[model samples]
Target: MSATQSYAHSRQQKLVVGFSQTPAPTTGLTRQEIRDLSLKGVKTRAASTAGSGRLHGKVAIITGAGPELAIGTGAARLFAREGAKHIYLLDYNPAPLSRLAEALREKYPNTKASPNPMRHSRSTVDQDGVLDLAVSALVDQAIQEEGHLDVFFANAGIIQRPPKRVGGGGDEIAEELRATGRNMGGIEDTEFMEVLRVNTLRWVEAGSNISYAFKSPIHARPWRAETLGIFGLSVFLGIKYASAAMAKTTSNKTKSVPGGSIILTASVAGLKANAGPIPYSASKAAVISLAQTTAYELAGSNIRVNAICPGLIETDMTRGAFEMARMAGKEGRMGVLNPLLRQGLGVEVAQMALFLASDDSSYVNGQALPVDGGLTASMPYIRPKL
Candidate 1:
């Protein structure tokens, strides 16, 4: 069979296997019992048949699955629900990572899920050797286990804490400005450089090294040399490398899957000013641009590149913000600016990532899709005229 045909046939077999393993639905529960549970806001896993198995037979990798209610963990759960064959999860913290893997296994017994603890240091990002060793090892592990990688979710990220003086209160706006100033000083500040190195440059390094996994030869080596000289190691490198990886054909002709999808976790901060701290917002803005430009570069190669710009989602990263609102008895005001008038869940953002990963979004590319509940639609000062 031709490679394309083999790919289709393999996917069909995997889907059938998944369907056969689906657990039977509960039949004895009465309508009233179900309603009571629903009214109580009881959460349940999606039944295996809940979705159309959009990611059937696909191999996926999710980085930064740290917090229990994190985007990476949410994506992993959703991917399994959508019938991804194998998921390789990475996180800096071993405790939450293992728990996420266990949760996936219990929910989707037929799917293969593994947790890996990998930490990336500042030296890892700045030094080529360290970055290559870390990123290449991840790609290699995925390939070794599944034989091919269909989707990569670069969801790992860090946010500089708001200044202590700015503790979540009435002075939040002013305190936030102070925090931004402290984190993002003059362009030459070492602390500012550190934030850039972790948030931006590391992504570029990982994206570039991941391209090697697809057996792509860097024909324009001089471009890297020239651009590095000009841009001085910015987020552009990650986009450049990831695009190259996505655009290349499989070195092993026997492997059925060739081109794949990449999903970057940007933020609404990237779309509008003051949404986040200065350094973070700037890095995410770069990520948004990267998604758009790379999608254009890899147009015909069957590789789709996209980004998810999330709004105020509850996670470890936002614990402080959430906690302060709760303490002030103003939790309801958390996401009042958005039309939804409520904060979002991690699963909501993950659902968007699932769309981009699956064939459901095959025609969608180069888009910085916002899962922010219409928050990015207008200026913050535009009040509803009552």
Candidate 2:
């Protein structure tokens, strides 16, 4: 059988296996409840299904690859299973990054996985004297070592949530978040300069003033390149650096045209309002725009740029919400608002990333694809029983 047919068969087998493992929900539940139960029925599947080696011999970089439930970590494991040459994992925390790298090595010995911790010190230069070069530095390293870069999944991002505390007002919580200055913009003097620096970039003005702005590795750096090029957030920096690296003609593929896949992790919140906080929504909207504009800008470069906007996925970023629901005994109703009626697993998002990263999406470019369980496809309406 052809490779395509074999893959289809493998997928079918996996689907059958997944269904067999999950029994049908009991009747008498509402339509939405039934749908939710059906979705949640299937346990979290392994990252690799058929191990068809779709990414064989390709070098890929994935940021935000730390937590066990993070989207980047899942993609890293999946990419490695698919026979990637090497996977560079980056995250702000060193411990988790190291752990993930070690795990990948043990599972996929053939694939080289390196953990590069991107420390977010409040300065241009950190202890290692590396100039806050999160994505750019990594891109350069990959090119030097591999002679070419293939897939770059900019999956690093954060969402600021007000801490739950007794006797703390909204203003107090906001102030507390500002004091942390985790991403940028402090409480007083430091905050003003951070705001100015962020605004001077102009492209990310909306997020500059947000003290507790959602951030990623790319957002930690004020400027991506030495010449002060492409001023924006995490995914923006990823597009700028990754695209540049991908466009270069390396020694290994000197005669061939430069080509690669750049996948940005946006959010369904970016597609519409009432989905996320004001700052987060605005930042994600910018991410979607970047994917669109950059695809056109690099039209003939053979580098396909796309954004995957996930919805209600149970990743490290959204673990709190899931935990709250479970604590309230409403875990089963976590994602009932969506047509799918259940929260999506990180592996599900990884599957979408795999599609975009592989040659399967060679012709697909400059698009913002939603992987949100059909959440954005419909408006606010109750599901009626047949």
Candidate 3:
């Protein structure tokens, strides 16, 4: 066999042996216990957890923090462990959010976790307006209880699939594209717009004229759309409310500082092509732009805005790809595009989030930092024997 094939074969053998198809009871632990231990090991080894009161007395909000293995959930747990006074978890799905909140409460008794469902039953107004009300209410509650807002992690997003077209020229083009495993051209107008709306704009409220008059090359535009059938919130609105809450002076603390950290979840796809679907990539690119622009707009206020661009992470969102690779015995091939030569876990991304959310990244602002294991550091090229 060739050197490449030999290496791949060796790796595959290791994977097969290292991870058993089923947990062996010889370890003297239940299946769930083993899973929990593995998770704890990953978190412990990923970074130092020496308690230093990094976020003591700080109130924070994290969206998309519902799933057990999601990046947002990892961040919420990290923040709680690091002494965050309160964490408000928001997600479209209430069941998972509530379960996550309960888990956090059990794991970290000192930290207060509130699971909030970002859903609205009212159809009287634009769906965006309903979201605006829901967000506003959450922020208000955080302020009323904690008296200060410290961190806002805008990590909620969706990887949209274009609906199958029928009986038209567009449908023909879509079929051709799908045959090649490309769906960008097949995406419908409404679906494309929905991705943009849910991924980029954070709708404040209907008929409310909010403007950013600061003279910078970047200009903020008013986004108005009838709530499409899809429902999800975006990062722009998080910045809008979080920044405002961060700027307020709280009576509980003397000599209060008007500054906080806002972390937006972007992706490696946003930084380069072929990393994700067109709409998802474009939306993430907009997120990076929002980070840069908002950092400037909120300048001198001590509120740092930045984006985290993750590469190949094994989360619920990307679990299908991982499962498929494993089923095909191509797990060793996963994440080979990155220098790490392995897939990253959500806790790994959570470490970066922790740094940004804490005072450690106080000087970092308006940057799109990639936690992609140096994938974007260079072009795709095979290593040469020296």
Stretches > 4 Å off in candidate 2: 1-44, 117-132, 161-230, 253-255, 381-386
> Which candidate leads the pack in TM-score?
3
Query: Model 1, 8-65: lDDT tens per residue?
Result: 5554444334332333257565433433343234135332237568898887767667
TM-score (all chains, Cα) for each model: 0.71, 0.72, 0.75
Q: Write the per-residue lDDT of candidate 3 for residues 104-180, one digit (tens) a residue.
A: 88988898874543333210111122165656577777777668888988887876653466456654434433433
TM-score-based ranking, best first? Answer: 3, 2, 1
**If the candidates were sorted by their lDDT against the true structure, best first, what order would they fall in?**
3, 2, 1
Prediction 2 global C-alpha lDDT: 0.67
Give the number of the best model, judged by lDDT: 3
Question: What would the per-residue lDDT of candidate 2 be over residues 27-137, giving only the tens digit for each residue?
Answer: 545544455555555343463266788998888888777788888888988898899888877666777777877888898998887554333211111111111365567
Give lDDT: candidate 3, residue 266.
95
Which one wins by TM-score: 1 or 2? 2
For model 1, where is the 10-residue window of minimal lDDT? 121-130
The models' CA-based lDDT, in order, is 0.64, 0.67, 0.72
> 1 or 3, which is superior by lDDT?
3
